[model samples]
Target: MLDQNTSAQLKTLLERLESPIEIVATLNGSDKSDKIKELVTEVAALSPQVTARFDGTNKRAPSFGIAKVGEQPRVNFAGLPMGHEFTSLILALLQVSGYAPKVSDEVLAQIKGLNLTSDFDVFVSLSCHNCPDVVQALNLIAIYNPDTTATMIDGAFFQDEVEERKIMAVPMLFQNGEHIGQGRMTLEEIIAKLDTGAAAKDAEKLNAKESFDVLVIGGGPAGNTSAIYAARKGIKTGIVAERFGGQVMDTMDIENYTSIQKTQGPKFAAEMEAHVREYGVDIMNLQKVSSIKGADETANGLVEVTLENGAKLESKTVILSTGARWREMNVPGEKEYKTRGVAYCPHCDGPLFKGKRVAVIGGGNSGVEAAIDLAGIVEHVTLVEFDTKLRADQVLQDKLNSLPNTTVIMNALSTEVVGDGSQVTALKYKDRATDEEHTVELAGIFVQIGLLPNTDFLKDSPVELSKRGEIVINERNETNVKGVFAAGDCTTVPYKQIIIATGEGAKASLSAFDYIIRSGQ
Candidate 1:
């Protein structure tokens, strides 16, 4: 039961409520407990102005049903209602009840088709928040793109997935075919690549496949470093990506990435790309790599690279830097209107939704970052998560709470994305506490939940795979497959950072050179 202090706090929060609010009752093991009933009644009495109901089976939760105000507001609670729990629940209620919450329509337009298909995934690091702009940008795009939904998985949380995808850096994206793209890209840039240009969309898919000296698949920090190193070493290096900048680009500010104290993912990615140009590396942006197969060992040990565009190439070594993807809510209409109101990658698309209202999925660090970032870029930022509490550290949680424009909702799952062909206008989610469903109006959505690996390209290969699906490699950065070296997020490198990737890339180059020399290539 909530103490007087807690109940009083809830009452105080309700005073500002202009709309209806849901207050589901907490469910306990007891089926015939009067205590639960009394608790529910007490809570309702405390916030008579706001709505209060029970959790599972008509039992009273502190806050469950939507209020009867002008707008029905709903807040969810998955677990028992206690300490600091009410804060999250209460905030969600207020957000759902209110309208126009100081958000901009332009920003809302950017995030129209979020909650689309479960195709898109974004990965991010803790230390890579550039003024919270990265999260804002992603929130805008997630609102619109439904076929390719967006999510921000924790770089450290998904260890097995990271290893499997060889993710050695933060802020990456993983799409279907296990093809990964890293770096910071604007919504326009991301959509352009995913849309499939003339070559990739209309051409015949390559079955046999070709190869390259350094076919750095994926364009995250690790892949970027691999390309830079390969190019610098005078080897034929090519960076193929759905777009550039990988997941790092999704991060607005990067304080932990070495050399640069504070840098946005997009800027960092552009600089890295520029540096690679100095070394003459081939950057195949907006290209799709479909399959991979081995070639007969030539005297020069040539590898083949086949593209979805029917283009092919040959090289001596291959570097796999394919990244990861984000998890989804698996709700209705999520796949129907992608990119219309739904988005991921707050940094790339947040500006488009400036002064607009948006919703963020997930309660982890990435979600926290998104809310904080979007608060600055958009008029109002709504953070939604199924977890009972935020998974982010205390400092991050505190920062999120302090943001005036940010409202966090816990113990809720989006059930449907309501909108038409052009964009998303509202969101419907289920309250885990009371099992009641409610809908709220919003312009955009951003998903920052979790990640999935992008290693489908290596399924048939002889490269030794770990149980987690990451490529097994020695400290030297050479893969079990000869002349086929892997590095960056594509390898099971211990650390994921720009500096670390640069070192690994350098190490990989040296190893590749040694193999070439020993084989007399």
Candidate 2:
């Protein structure tokens, strides 16, 4: 129910939004083309007060925030007005349409009802595209309560700044400017982080939160395995993952991992997570490590992991299963609306989309594989390829073609993904030949692009990352850095498979144990 005051504010915002918003379309470094002028006129007519203008001043790279200077707003005219930013425009509309800086009673009430009003900052990188959903949820809280402001900064773009803050991974959250948690978190954990009560923290014994016996940085097969092992070994472990399952989470069917003929990706992830939980692992979901600084080893020879959370954790051993993320289109909205409708793994969220329509954006083996799998669940699967022909293996291509609900859109380029918040609605495509335009209504879009290692955080750390972003190590999966061992998709190994990651996990554990013995600990 809307309060009278809140309703009035929303209505006023709606009026301002309906009153013509200005957007200018311009081609950078080009002569003043008539097309630019015509489009600017079209945008001006949409907003009563907003006017479109193009200046040749050539704006600097993206600044901290959008700057407005005098009557003329800094002009950046993107020609064709298409692609990822399309949704950004929509978001701007909604934010303004519902704008009431002071917020409403229900929201205000929720704020007053919070366990804590302290602010938490989460820093993330574009590489960790799986994080937008987490950031958005935090942003929602910040909306209702101005005391907390959760903002996401591109770690790569602001590498120096992130380093200053000691950020090692993406989606890492800070609690009251302190390190409250890391990795994946249940709703309960989230509320705990939001907890302002004194009793709960005392019961939870957060006084020991600053110390860890083992710090496991990946939530995939290896990291999960290590966490379970460490917890059983009676060493408190903190597992940090951008998303709990890493690249494997993006994978569909897992017939390779031991003990199961075949299983869904997320189910496997959940099981691994369960195994760790049964042993009481301190797992922080959606947690990204921004940086790692170590204190002197304890008397027992445990390495201390000091994360960007401003908390110092004493861990005897650190496992590097930090894993990798899918390679993206590098377009705008891809980063903004990743989990909303744009997904990476088909199997994890595929079942929830039964009978819905969707599209797959790659033509490689993974792309074809995703389309074929999605066809079984979704009503229709449109496979869009930018290249002239499919690049997947002939066998996979044949399988994709055999699927009834799958349609191949070759020689097409996906210029834009349009959606209405909660889910994706349409995808705009363009042809390279006759310049034909195409659009398809899709409920979900899975990107079968590729992957990159999450090693940007190990910059000055002792860990040695491979050229391809995999952690460089010896035959035992041990890195050049002492007391550091890496495994899984982020390692310098060929053939990315679940079984391989698990094997490496066992190997890494054994090696770590051996390292401990050799030191006479």
lDDT of each: 0.61, 0.61
Q: Which lDDT tens digits does candidate 1 get at residues 16-105?
A: 777555554544555323454555566667765655555434222222333334422222222232322233345444544553233346
State the lDDT of candidate 2 residue by residue for 1-521, as single tens digits: 23466445544543555333344333343343454555455434444554555543322222211112232222121222222222223333333233433344743454446734555555543333234434444544554443554444444444455545544334556766786543334333464356555234333443367656567888898888777766666655678765676666545467766679898665678778778888878876545566654333245456655444443455656788877777887664665556556777665445445677989999999899889888987899999998999999999999998888889998887888787654467888889787898889877788887778778888777677766767897889788766777887788887777888888887777676666667654
Give the poorly placed runs of model 1, Cα more than 4 Å off.
Answer: 1-213, 231-236, 295-301, 325-328, 347-357, 376-380, 420-422, 431-438, 460-472, 494-496
Deviation from native of the Cα of residue 435 in model 2, angstroms: 10
Q: Candidate 1, overall lDDT?
A: 0.61
- Model 1 TM-score, 2 decimals: 0.55
TM-scores, all models, native as reference: 0.55, 0.54
Worst 10 residues of 1 by lDDT: 71-80
